[model samples]
Target: MQPNAESVVVLDFETTGLSPDQGDRAIEIGAVRLQNGVITERFQQLMDPGRRISPFIEEYTGITNAMLADAAPVSQVMAEFADFIGDDNLVAHNASFDKRFLDAEFARISRSYPGEFACSLLVSRRLYQDCPNHKLGTLVRWKNITGEGSFHRALYDAEMTAYLWLAMLADIREQSQLELVPFELVTELSKTAKKSVGAFFSRW
Candidate 1:
């Protein structure tokens, strides 16, 4: 996805477990629609995976099986989420994990989104090396992204991640003295060596 795109869907999924390959599935989906640097809309759903959530999963995400009991089925929820996503690019902390589940879930409903996925975690690792970790919670605390959402919850993490994405873009704009941060700049930044980021962007 073009990092500089005016609109993007920042998404996060709380799954029954890690690795969809091992039969795990998403229990909750949360996302914020960010357009022109503002969150204009939001989408969230608790899904039923046709199974009980593990104790650890329940505790970690605070999404109880009881809460999901009356929720929509996984396939039904996935279909609606696909519609909510429309064609917007996606952003996530560690996007690979989310992307994997997205692909898996969408396939169940014969839906797929072609937008590119960008990893804020990767971008942060390149931009901010002083931080001890690049986790969403770590970035939230390090950058002081103001809010009252707890970690592990999909909506809160997605909201916080959206703020963090904007913060980084703002930093880039002020530092480069550019009208708006270029999407290519962030794409390149994600692939650039940490030590070379400053020099690489300098030439832009």
Candidate 2:
């Protein structure tokens, strides 16, 4: 499916750790707004997760607890971010992971976030299956896309994801016959697959 102009918000989050439901929280959120394949604007913030930064997470993201001591709370950042997203489709590498953190943050503030989401990881698997490694770093290098900052930072990774998403779209167009499906349909199929897998496990 071809993405419409200004229809996508490519986003990423830097969190204290994985599993937002387990008390982890987003320490930073970043996103790039895209209109017709061009990035029109960006949003980024360091969030006060209201917890101590773990040494492992700090070493990974280079964001210390002290750095976020005065940062805005997740509620405020998410509010501003929700405004930026504005009902547009969202994109991320490993999107469900990021969405879990975002939804958890929103839940904490008693707000709801509902929108269409896309995963660049799935797109990469669909379009570049020959590549042995589908990690963001590996895919970025394989696609010859240059990332400005280190990995794990929200904005930098989001920027790279945006580029990678565009490139994957191009690759899919070049290689596939499924050219006319709507973006919404692609997203729905992905979500359905995830739910089917989850339901299977729950029943097991």
Candidate 3:
């Protein structure tokens, strides 16, 4: 697929804990839909996981159990989010974590959700290896990207990743010269690959 600024959905989730397989669930989900490098829309929601919120997680995200008592369940939120993402590629920092949670939620709802995904962490490591750190906070400081909310919140983190992805794209274009490379080759190279357009590029 063409890796243009458009046709991407930057997503993030705040969860009750680390392992969804252990019954951990998403407490919040957020995404920013972009078209041609501009955000066309956004989605953010607090989800009631029908479970208790551990004090550690609550403190970290400032989302107490009380706050989510009236929130919608993951099944409903995930369906809405799936529609928001449509057929576009999904973007996230350490995307597998988010994808796992999303996939598990879909599985619970008896719905299928297998979609293309891009990891900003992987992208950052490939494109900005010279930088000392690729952590979201470090990148924000290094790139001078401003974020409005606290860390650990889904929407804020997704927005931060979106901005970081844009900056990383600029770096990639400058280094690789807009020649399209298959995401698989980039994966194999452990970095973004430089390829002749005629030799690479595939539609997802």
Top TM-score hit:
1
Q: lDDT: which is higher, 1 or 2?
A: 1
TM-score of each: 0.95, 0.85, 0.86
Error of 1 at 125 (Å): 0.6
List per-candidate RMSD values in Å.
1.6, 6.0, 4.2
lDDT of 1 by residue, 1-204 (tens): 335544689999999989999999999999999988999999998999999999999889899989999999999989998989997888888999999999999988899997888888999998789999998888888998899878888898899999999998887776677776756677667888989878876886
lDDT of each: 0.88, 0.79, 0.78
Give the per-residue Cα lDDT of candidate 3 at 183. Answer: 41
Instruction: Indicate whether candidate 1 or candidate 3 has the larger lDDT.
Output: 1
**Residue-wise C-alpha lDDT for candidate 2, range 60-147, written one tens digit per residue:** 9999888899999888998888788887888899998998987887777787656678888876665565788889999999999986
Question: Which 10-residue window in model 3 sums to the lowest lDDT?
Answer: 195-204
Best by lDDT: 1
**Residue-level lDDT tens digits of model 3 in 1-204:** 545554478999999989898989999998998777788888999999998999999899999999899999888998888777777778888888998998898788877645577788876676666679888888888889996898788889989999987886666555556643344444433443534322332322
In model 3, residue pairs whose N, Cα or C atoms come closer than 3 Å (at least 3 residues apart or on different chains), thus clashing, are 1-202, 6-36
Error of 3 at 118 (Å): 0.7
lDDT value for model 1: 0.88
